[model samples]
Target: MDRSANLVSFEKIRKAAALIKGAVLETPCLPAPRLSQLTGADVFVKYENMQVTGAFKERGALVKLDSLGDDEKKRGVIAVSAGNHAQGVAYHAGRLGIPATIVMPVLTPFVKISATRGYGAEVVLAGNTLAEAKAEADRLAEENNLVWVHPYDDVHVIHGQGTVAMEMLAAQPDLDVLVVPIGGGGLIAGMVTAAKAINPNVEVIGVETTLYPGMWGAFYGKEVRCEGATIAEGIAVRDIGEITTEVVKKAVDDVLLVSESSIERAINAYLTLQRTIAEGAGAAGLAALLTDPDRFAGKRVGLVLCGGNIDPRLLSKIVVRELARDGKLVSIRIDTPDRPGTLGEIATVIGDMQGNVVDVEHHRLFLNVPAKGATLDVSFEAFDRPHGERIVAALRDRGFVVRYLEIGDRMD
Candidate 1:
């Protein structure tokens, strides 16, 4: 596919805005006061999380469904998504009285699959991965004579998703920087199109997980072969859309790849500090800001919080990981003589260091320790890394051999 400049004119985006006016909610643009303080940038979050389907996908899905003729609608629609798009298509199809069948990867979030099913769509669990699910969806569309509603490739869908930027700029035209999360390039493509049309001076940037830098490949002409697990799975497309790649190449200013840890931290921060539930992809724009605060410092920036459909179990895991990342949780292994009060002695040291022991496991028979020595793994939470280290050193100074299992960085 040619990565040339293919802009959806401002007129088309305006038409899309008109077409989707009463159908989609005009989500709020919230002030990010805490984030602004952290990054030295006046940050405002475009809260698409509160959209009817809990994602910006509703905008594009509704537009695409409305534009379809009666024949198309009667034929029903087939869509493949890991999560957000499936819900969007299913929800709008139900509202429009059109039959829809959605194909989802088996690995998709439980919340997303359940939401899509609740929207009155026949759900098909196709494959373990999204790419395979998409192949199955394409085959089903052909076999069942269903109209395919692509998540991000079509021109109509591009126009539909651009409405986010339209409403965003309308709410705050002075936004100097726009940070968007990329999946298959649809959302950011639409955003850049509308944003550049309104204010060409605005810096339109894209954010992706380092594990799945699809947009990075489309922009920088890389091989486009990132494949791994990411918290922001909603934006983890391996392939870039043809139209979207062109629009992005012409209009997008920069594409930054962020770490999974950054995404997890952003999700936790939004949940705890902002009192918002943003899914991995939804928190991605904020992750970019946190990754390189210096780039956006003092600028009035706009971010698209793309979606909010996450499984409860996954959310719990993210919270736990975030705590560990922030040094609040530490797990350590200690070798001690199998004598009385050995465990009590370690507990006393941890308490003295102001660390609260959360859990402990002792290994006697499993280890190769002598009859007099045993292995103990203790987990605790502390105020920070320094406090946790103090507890470790205190135990060492007291003639105990201790090693912190969680002290090493994953970077190694």
Candidate 2:
């Protein structure tokens, strides 16, 4: 079916809101005081991660599943996703007693794959990226005569995602700007439609990570390469949806491209400040706020925390890395003479300053170091940036060559 020709109207979104009301969770749309303080914008967050499948995809998946015919349901539904969409389709399809087949990239997180399988869908790992997985899904669907459940391209999915904007406006009608993340553009397309119809004056902004600017390119008519293993892998689409591109081209006010650091900062901010979990794509809207705070200053902004399907291990690393960036954690390398008490002396200075040592590494015979001297890498926890600086200062006063690893060496 050519869904590109079928544009989603506000009325269709309202109908979808009504049809999928009881089937999906009505996630909270509430004020975020800390986020507001951190970003210079009056911020409100729509918690789509509260859904059973931990994403907004549940709405679109349920609408698509429920709209299936008996024969179509019997033949099964096939979809391509590496994250939330796969789980959403698997979960709701299982609920509707429809067989579900999910094709995911081979490198897709195990947590997402397990969750989809737990919902009784047959999971297939194929290709190396979302587009390749999609190709595999198309092949499987044609072979098995399965019904296709396009994640973002179908009219039903776009309308389904629009319900989030409806619920947000119903709860907080005074929002001046709606900032939504764009992967294949469905969420922003639906949201811009609803938001513009409700308040024509309300600004609709689309956010994309710098690594994958598919929607940004589509919105601005540019041909840019979309590559990289970004932390926000959920929005790592190389191709934008035809239907969504059409809607976005007409409705979106502007698209903001945010860097990976901004996204990581946003995720950490959500975790520490809001006491919530936000995956990379889920944090894109807030990332835009962080990277370009001036643009949103004084405006009441609505941010969609689209999904929280991040792997636990990845989340832990991100949190620690953020702490390092914030100076709450410090890893410093010291060049000292090959003496036993030299390491103890540095440790004592840190301990005296009330810093807790986290890790210690000893290196000898490095070409850069003097023949008589050895290198010691010490990691410690600090209360804050000032405290970390104080620790470094104390070590410097002791006449040791101290170099901070956190600031000097950052992963790109």
Candidate 3:
């Protein structure tokens, strides 16, 4: 299937590049040495997160808005999105003097809701899911005579997203593969169309969270269940777009599914190793690489860091969780006599071992603990796994009953 002929064409994408040239940033595509070392692939990251709205959605949003007729623009536009697309349309529409209305799920993060409103778009919190939100957007669009600017599934939007690939190829024409995240499939579809047209030899792979394999399920003709509270909420789509599914069927070489843990690790890697912030969906491409290094080893791989609008609190939790996974943070429980010196001895041992105590809890009411005995739950920061182990071993040598605590361990 020649998707370029029937769906979005290379020529149209080129025009979109010209139309949105100055409106959207041409984010840098730079080599990432640390990521390359970690993934065993010569990695280059297209920093789409560096855009003014901190995502690549602005490119497509501006193109779609610009294509509207004067009368249509006057009537304003309506769109349904989780967050990134909402901000994209809201920001660009405001700049173009076009009133925009965004319908977002009620459960959307407060940060995104506030950001969309800040961009001058009237935000309507509707539905528990994107599908439900779209229904409300459709009804509102018809009632108010507003122009419907789809987040994906439109030719202009697809063409606009293709500009990302055009820029990527222009920067590194010899890239062996392009790893992109998939939601409603607009980004990957456009990227596949442009990348394949520019360099047929370059493989284009799409990534989706395991919780929402909308594109993957569509491409493979399987009834994969799609529902979960994924940290990558930007890509947690249950339904793939009709236009995008067609493009994926014809052009996308493969689609990969990554787990929540892998996504968290990838986000942490971007912050600690690359010195950058990558939202959950943004880190999915790198998560694929981490999932299967051998597939891309020794090849020149390009990853689109598509968005960086993650909630600060979520990002902090992911960072701390990763630290605990790496043994840099640890929690331990010690059973000792309910005496003052018992706590002091444990603290002294931890301090003497160069561990920093983060928190401590005293439990005396536990039925299992003797009346004179108490349980001390201590959370501490350690240099590494070995260092933590040495501390635990030292505590044991002092005749204290010690137990290491895993994440999600319940006290009861």
Clashing pairs in 2: none
Give me candidate 2's TM-score against the actual structure: 0.96
| lDDT, model 1 | 0.87
lDDT of 1 by residue, 1-412 (tens): 4533354666877999998887888999988898788667899999999987899998888888988999999999999899899999999899999999999988888889888999999999998777889889989999999998999997778888998998899999899999999999889888888998899899999999998887798789887667887788899888778888888887799999989888988899888878889999999999998999999989999989899888888898888777777788998888889989999999998998789999888877763666778888888998987888888888899998887676332211
Each candidate's number of clashing pairs is 1, 0, 0
Instruction: Output the number of the TM-score-best candidate.
Output: 3
The C-alpha stretches of model 2 lying farther than 4 A from their native spots are 1-6, 365-371, 407-412
Worst 10 residues of 2 by lDDT: 403-412
The sequence of per-residue lDDT tens digits that candidate 2 reaches over residues 1-412 is 3356356889989999999888899999999999999999999999998999999998988888888889999999999997799999999998889999999999988889999999999999999899899888999999999999988988889889999999999999999999999999879888888889999999999999998998888778888999998988899999888888888888789999999999999999999999999999999999999999999999999999999998999889888999998899999888888977988899899999999998888877667767898888888999998999999999999998988896335212
| Candidate structures ordered by lDDT, highest first | 3, 2, 1
What C-alpha lDDT values do all the predictions have? 0.87, 0.90, 0.93
- Model 3 reaches what TM-score against the true structure? 0.97
